[model samples]
Target: MGERAYNFGAGPAMMPDAVIERVAREWQDFRGEGYSAMELGHRSEHFADILARAKADLRALLDVPESHHILFLHGGATPHFAMVPLNLAQPGESADYIHTGYWSDKAMAEASALVNVRIAASAADSEFDRVPDRAGWQLDPAAAYVHICSNETIGGVEYDGDPDTGNVPLVADMSSNILSRPIDVARYGLIYAGAQKNIGPAGLAIVIVRDDLLERVRAGVPSVMKYARHVEWDSMYNTPAAFAIWVAGLVFEHVRKAGGVTEMARISVEKAQKIYAAIDASSLYINRIQPASRSRMNVPFFLREPRLEQRFLDGARRRGLLNLKGHRATGGMRASLYNAMPLAGAQALADYMTEFERKNG
Candidate 1:
């Protein structure tokens, strides 16, 4: 196999080389079945086993309580933006959302169309560089659920810890940082993540809904959008994303074998630190987000001289540093240091930044 560049693209992002190799090895003949994994039958026993193993590995790894059901939804985390309000709250009922960054704002924007979305707390006043302090949150006790994006992929801001939303169901869109650390599943009312970030491939979202919330589905909600129905159908409400789920299963197993989330967290912190250190130490580079709120997964920084942005990116590409461009919504440079990125990848990025700064600063 020839060398592969480190993929820092946010979604459809870098996957563990081992998982990619395993997929390649099995793509044509899944376990000697002689059928391509893409051709896998969702209802077949083979897929059942694959799904069960993925769920089990994820459950065991995260210690998801018996009170929750893990769902492998077809759309990436987006559909849940609408499905969540529809399933969790009655039409026109209010739900509290903490506006943190681009994705969180998107969630609020989507939910506002379906429900009375209340901004319990927001950092927009600060330009979305950090999470609104939890102390200032004015939560609605009667709201259906309190939603937060544990890690904002675009703005590169992340929560330092699980928030205490007393008595309210805390729902989080952990799309960018789900498996990067261990979470107390019991603390959340529901947790959903699109697979493009820390999990497997894109187009799949994981939903861990507390069992009791199943009965609360507002009447008239479509069967497909209803959580209870999906739970009863065992994530088979519609034709599942078989290939993505299968690949996700392999990724889950790979994560488990690599010492699970604790180890992933350890490595993630170090990798992020390596890159952030480079930015903080340089005068020409800048990360405006507060230190405590900086993300451990996506690190976005800007060059002091915007004119050199393209030149820096071009140089980075020539060095095999791919996808360092920031989200189009926020113009700058972003390096998504997901679990698949090796320590060497982070070091290489830091080294390149240093060399670039020394030459251009």
Candidate 2:
């Protein structure tokens, strides 16, 4: 276990070691039950207890209000791109979107196919290195909702705080950064995230939607896609991702035992600061995003000599730092500082970067 390399991939990223160990121990039989969690019937009392506990732990960790319903749904955040407009926005009604980076653009493209999409603000002009100011957002007062990708994994941009949308409900795709910090759940009408980065695994998505917004589902929308149906059925309208939910449940408990989101946020900031300081001091590496908009979760940096990228990756891997390569579309490297990544891991990467620059610069 100690020999494992530090993982920094964008999604399906690192999880708490405690959570992994617990899963491994219970993989064959959960809590001495006759069957594995995956094999247990979803309707069985045992599995129902698991589901209830997971939801409760998550709610406590996030301090979710009773007014919001937490649904452990099947599809990842991508599917919600269509489901959002399908359930919330009418065919002709527009939904305002703030396009920050790759994921946000994909979200808008998917929503556009279902309903009218208004680009309220975009940072494409800056190659997605920054988030546009809230003051410049051109929101439609009549739009059903205002959507934003709270954190951009590929572009390394993040909103420092929630954007004010007045009466329009705020819907955020918080896939990469959810649970990494303390967020005000009340400020968002809906917050959806794939349980890969900071949650648990890849097959599940956690959706926190305000109860009142569930009444807006468009006619003819599939029962499975409707948030109301999920809430009514307790996220079990169909067979849920039992194994993933079990693991996420363990993670939620782990977070709570480890001092919750406030502690997670403190460590996340420290990790990002350590790595970003190294990048700032080195002439060989450069982070393109402006300081204000830079993401504390994903730090995308570039090598001064593009040809040295492979060498850098190789060196980092040999040094037990893994997945430091950036997204292919943008090139260079990215270090995703998720909640499960310890401060020691970030410091190790920072140290490696400094030594690499000294040897290669």
Clashing pairs in 1: none
Residues 192-245 of candidate 2: C-alpha lDDT, one tens digit per residue = 999999998797999999999998998999899999999999999999988888
Task: Give the clashing residue pairs of candidate 2, or none.
Answer: 326-333
Candidate 2 RMSD to the correct structure: 1.1
Task: Return the lDDT, model 1, position 100.
Answer: 93
TM-scores, in order shown? 0.98, 0.98
Q: Give the Cα lDDT of each candidate.
A: 0.92, 0.91
lDDT, candidate 1, 292-349, per-residue tens:
8999999999999999999999999988899999999889999999999999999999
Please count the clashing residue pairs in each candidate, in the order shown: 0, 1
